[model samples]
Target chain A: MKTEKTLVTITEEMVLNYEVIFGKQNKLPPTFPMIFYRYINVPWDYKTAPIHRKQTCVCHSELSIGESYHCVVTLDQVKQKGKYMFYTQSLVGYNLEGSECFRCVSELVVH
Target chain B: MCVRISRTLTITEEKIKQYAFLSGDFNQIHLDQKEAERYKFKEPIAHGMLTMGLTLEIASSFTEKGMRISTYEMQFIKPIFQNDLIYIVAKKKKQDYGSIYLEITGRKQNELVVRGELALERLSSIHFNNATKESGM
Candidate 1:
């Protein structure tokens, strides 16, 4: 199991940029977790790279701008199905109080 | 108990590129035509989250009064090729206490591409507005 962590902050500019393209909303978009992907830092083969197949996000608290989050991504499990490797990873965010603000579990299929 | 809204969206390469840079996925399957052709897809695919983000925007519109998302789950049933138009729909499931449930669906060319469920927590209008106003939203 590989675990990686990074501090993520949602700046006003990011929200503005997203809103410009996706439209403005009262709350940060659920896709806000995407900011954590750069920290994935994992290497893979493009010819047989993992493709996103499923996602689940549970929000425990509302995300406010300027909130610093400790984001963590971990490889939870892997299964080989014929010619594909189904990998499941858990992504979570914690607020200053160390309380879970959100969790997103992503399943990727690699050929 | 039942409500529905639908819209047609055309996702462009420029849109996918923006998401790629923001998310930092850079899987090549989502960018780089030559690299993407190396795979079985033979064409670039949009990020799954990009679609999810759009879905959320739709839900947010429905809850502008005071509701906020609580839980969202999505299944990528099929690959959505870039520059293709996708039809999205959101239907109200039910409401319990201070929460409203919704079922979301996305399709490309009449083929189901993604399906998901969304739950929104009902908050006081003033409360929700106050939270967002802090950011000058």
Candidate 2:
């Protein structure tokens, strides 16, 4: 059987799921390059906001030293006003030799 | 090629409900079976992120200080239903600058459900300090 891939879409439900599974103690990582969001709580209603359609590119191959692959995430724009919005957020990948790569999600907002 | 990483994790409505309650996700696609029927699957399915995060636990199994994923990507090609036992697998791909690349797969009943690549960076004082400084610390 062929291996299937999962596209990571940011919705209100996703935030809710993360909260339910990881709990507040395991909050989602903050927007990269900015730690200010670390203190901001992930509101349960975050799922109720509008989000960009995200395209996830998950590679399933191993890499050697000095090798790198890009995980490009495309963020769609929101049309509704004051309904909240999400953007295509980028994260730096890891360097562990054998562990799985990072599983980071995009950003959601009330914009 | 396909590999097995974990025991079959049975997907259940009750489990889905708890995830919904915790994630605050009210998407009809995951909660209302009738609503999901309108979709191709014709039933509620597990949240993609939920499945993604669950793999992190599997990553923890291989390390002690904990695994830090730096990059990850996946495509949702199949619908995974509740009560379905999913066999999970994660493999080491490569390493750069204390970061590791991983190939992850999730399958149910010997069928592939999801696959993706993940990159994990270790939390190091030198790396962290350099990263923070590069960001204008």
TM-score of each: 0.88, 0.55
Q: Write the per-residue lDDT of candidate 2 for residues A1-111, one digit (tens) a residue.
A: 111222222345445545465443232332111211122233233344322232242222222234332322223333344744444443323333433233234433433
Q: Candidate 2 local accuracy as lDDT?
A: 0.49
Worst 10 residues of 2 chain B by lDDT: B61-70
Q: Where is model 1 more than 4 Å wrong at Cα? A: A39-47, B124-137
Q: Which ten residues in a row have the lowest lDDT in candidate 2 chain A?
A: A30-39
Interface RMSD of 1: 2.4
Candidate 2: regions farther than 4 A off: A1-111, B1-7, B125-129, B132-137
Instruction: Spell out the clash pairs found in candidate 1.
Output: none
Docking quality (DockQ) of candidate 1? 0.50
Evaluated on chain B only, candidate 2 has a TM-score of 0.79
